[model samples]
Target chain A: MRVVLVAGTTATAKIPEISAAGADPTLVGHTPSADAEIIEYGDTVRSPVTPVSPTGCPTPAAITRAVRELTGFDVLTVDAGLAKPTAAPTIDVGARPGRDIREPEPVPTAPGAFEAARRMGLALPEDELVIGETVPGGTTTALAVFRALGETFPVSSSLPSNPTSLKEDVVAEALESAGLSPGDAAHKPKLATRYVGDPVLPVVAGLTVGALESGSDVTLGGGTQLLAASALARHAGAAGDLTLATTSYLADDVPELESAAAELDVDLVVTDPGFETTPLDRYAAGEAKEGAGMGGALMLADRMGVVDDVEAATLDVLSRLDPQAVDGVEDGP
Target chain B: MRVVLVAGTTATAKIPEISAAGADPTLVGHTPSADAEIIEYGDTVRSPVTPVSPTGCPTPAAITRAVRELTGFDVLTVDAGLAKPTAAPTIDVGARPGRDIREPEPVPTAPGAFEAARRMGLALPEDELVIGETVPGGTTTALAVFRALGETFPVSSSLPSNPTSLKEDVVAEALESAGLSPGDAAHKPKLATRYVGDPVLPVVAGLTVGALESGSDVTLGGGTQLLAASALARHAGAAGDLTLATTSYLADDVPELESAAAELDVDLVVTDPGFETTPLDRYAAGEAKEGAGMGGALMLADRMGVVDDVEAATLDVLSRLDPQAVDGVEDGP
Candidate 1:
């Protein structure tokens, strides 16, 4: 059996404006909840707003749901930390929503969430495991963690124009707030996640460790966020078959992603899904690059010979979500 | 992989004195949590009290822990409902602690918890699943559910004197409080769980259904409580490879248990574990009949050729818990 775990976090509050994963800055907090709901139930179950980018491009949850419908892998939502409660039935790993990355203690509940998720992961029967995350402004937290861990990489974003300098500025303030230098968390890797990382990082890292211990081949199913998780896993003394799966959009946006995975001793699998030639080609044009396990779902679909089905299913979903989008044909991607 | 899921419930508050599963009434709610802790982490992590019967007999968790150590199956705790929080990492299914079974509405959160647990169960990889429970006063609720579903049998207790009449009276009151008559829930099994059953019953029943759907061999891992879960599954229109696993003590106490499983079209497996000749023979003597998946753990251990290791490890656990009991060497059990 193949399992996809989509986790939510709230540390995105620091750079919500820069994130286009939702319609508005306030709606960014609900992006993970909506993404999780969209995958688990085939549509947004409870949230008033649909999960989409600022220009009305669908979140990758729609694509993940499309692949899930085409294939048969199970999806489980993990409430790592989300501002709004999800309508889908979820595994609650964290006790509280995340604080801003610039706070003295951004994720005080991370250790507990990580341990709980680790326990759950350790018990999973051996199979294919995919860990994904949805924190609207998580790239900033990812950058903060990378800088704290003494790694150099500008994280990619869902927005068309990557806000590299803004993320760097946020990480600077976060390091100062947490009383840390750039390389402080290199030896003490947990300190990066404790002080500046989002709730999703620790949970994904812990699950990666435990899932590896269970002899299951794990796929870290996001962009730089998952790379940070791999770093944490390696630092925590866990070693096994670890594969980082993402999309071509992210690879094209951040050229250093491949080298980062290579430095962490993790393999990478990037799926194109032919979105560039399909109706959802804006994905190739960089409108919501990846979130909600999109890259991993497409990779699994590719292995199952159903990757060709994602485009039509995703188109049908978008049509139902907003009939006018498809009715106007070339008006919207 | 083989999985043991231990769940806690709080519906036994009204009949606490009749239950010997804990040292005191208040401590009963902690039994399942402590049992989960023992099996998951090898000891009770947080609760101040040790989970033992009134006569200082070790709870079945000690045996379950020993079985886990010998045969490396994983153990998970599900917080169905408990007054005090558990120290072990848990997948919290239910929202609130249970109310008295003899209330107008006993388990209002049953439906939500059932759905959440079902979602989780459906995602489990194909594996052997053992579902167990700890509810100090669960027998009454089980009897009530049995009566509501038109089955007749005296429920067994942890105490040597089975307290059949007291349990019967409690069930009668519970049925009256729920405004239900005998066989009222025959075609409406969920109603019985909602009105007359404890929190664990719905979660166990829901998990049973989804796990069965997931193509795993499912084992209900306690005595009559698990029987109630099986009945709920049958009434909920779920059918698959179902096995009712219990101890010889329960089989001897409830002569109709085998017939009840036969009527439910479920197979029954009773494990003896040779406790009569071991230092922990009090289990055979009915000091603590069965809970914490003891029978299922023993069955797994027997298959793995480690059933004989349980007695010695149980004795060691008991000795560490209360050294005076084992020092005299023949005074306790």
Candidate 2:
């Protein structure tokens, strides 16, 4: 099956204090996203000066890259709001980084961003499009987008121990600054995103709308960020083919996601990467749940009957990411 | 031929007092460009409040729109930097309106714009592309781009009166603000565009590069603006089938265009548009000389063997624009 994987990075990822998206804070300085792209291009993402994040265990890019290798899908990287230039050739959206959500205009170019995203969406092949993103503090911004879109629910993060309270506090302040109440975001998604959402949200929303409007099957790849986009798409009166494909990690997150999917009438395609018994056991243990289009990429693999290859590659990638973890695991059949 | 017409409007057009783009200042305010799109869509451009510029006689949109009707070419409008949203379904590049060139960073998002335009260019059908534009005040910004690109040459304006002195003044101030000398622009096209060029230049250049790289014959429609784009494409290492298509209106304003074309080793495709003895006499009279991708649209019509239809339609559109001028001309054969 022909599929296009879209990756976008946003600065909101850096603000989440204990983001499990990287091995450490220093590795979080745009390296993870950049490394993710390099890995997807089948290149060793190692730089002497840059501390590359281990893709296998904590970040979704490594897993997504493995999925690409297993599934052999076409990938396109988009710099929706990357603070730094990436290592690979990326379709730069030319959007600025989102300011701290506390500001009233975190993404001042939100409307224009939709236009850019729509253009990208229109440019794609007329096949099912799997849209993914790799913003470091994406979950926080996802939560903000969700809340801004009037979804009053908590979201999962890269941290094994989700910082639900901190995220809630951040979203509250952002909503307040935007002069929005609980249900206000649904009415003006563009304005809400401009005031509080990260750069990727509006873009993803636009991509979804553009693809759907043009009659293509679209799977929003990620967890709540896509959910926010799904909400925006529905709010924008989009009546196209759309599904939310994610990992079982998010399916287990349940509650908010289930209600959101039901409300939006979006089909769900969740996959179990079977990382529990492998070296990448942390994902089963609930660390680094989803990013870099991992969920959708894995779903495509599962659909193509290459889930076993995906699982093996995930372990191999994890081995490269964390050599010490290799000693801890037994060989698989 | 399946062709796409990319039109970008810049706020810079509003600055020129006597633009060759329109007969009056009020007509210049986005109407000329918008009318071009409307005519291309095969509709009358009459809005009492909007002061629609006569596309047939003055700007090329009327002429190009006529060509589209005769040949049924696929048209895609691009909003590279429109001051206002267009009436049609445009492939919005999500670019901001360009600030006056006097600013140090007039088109700040130029590099990102290349990425956007390149994506649009790459998405088009694998056929010869006749890309056109309809930005008002595009000439002054074109002059700035040419000068910034290190070319010591003059550019044509939409006004028959040729506001060369005024354009030179604006460009001088812009170049000074950008801290650039002659020949600096060739080395730094993006930087030069950012400092002084309008939003359309980089986009068109990117579109040209994208189409050329993808192994397609590309004809940059319009006059000096496209010349500036050609220079940027060459500087960016575009080694592909490229040609510059414009009207005799611009060819008559030759010298600088000829030198620039010769320097770029680009072929020139100049169509007389036969406005001399036609009801579009004012165009021959040099009132509103070129704009709205009229020149390229005419060339494409000529290439397709429909120049007569284009001319007849130009007169028809002109009559709709200014009925008083219709009484002065004989009926078409």
After TM-score superposition, the amount by which residue B103's alpha carbon in candidate 2 deviates from its true location, in angstroms, is: 25
Which pairs clash in the backbone of model 1? Answer: none
Q: For each candidate in the order shown, give its overall lDDT on alpha carbons.
A: 0.77, 0.67
Q: How well is each residue in A1-333 modelled by candidate 2, as lDDT tens digits?
A: 333344444455556473665556655656444554444444332222222234335456667778776765655555566655443434445566777777778888789878777766764544678887766676777788777676765677766677888888888888888788776777677877788887877888888888887787899878887887888888778887789988898878755687778778898888898877766666776766776787888888888898878767865665565443343333211
Candidate 1 lDDT, tens digit per residue, A1-333? Answer: 445454665555546466887777777778887787677656564565677777777788888888887875655567777678565545566546778888888888878877877776775544768888888777788888888888886688788988878778888998999999987888555577889988888888888888898888899877887888888888778889899999888888878888888988999999888888877887888878888888888888888898888889888767655443343233664
Chain B of candidate 1 vs. true chain B, TM: 0.94
The candidate maximizing lDDT is: 1
Which window of 10 residues has the lowest lDDT sum in candidate 2 chain B?
B44-53
Tell me the DockQ of each model, to 2 decimals.
Answer: 0.06, 0.03
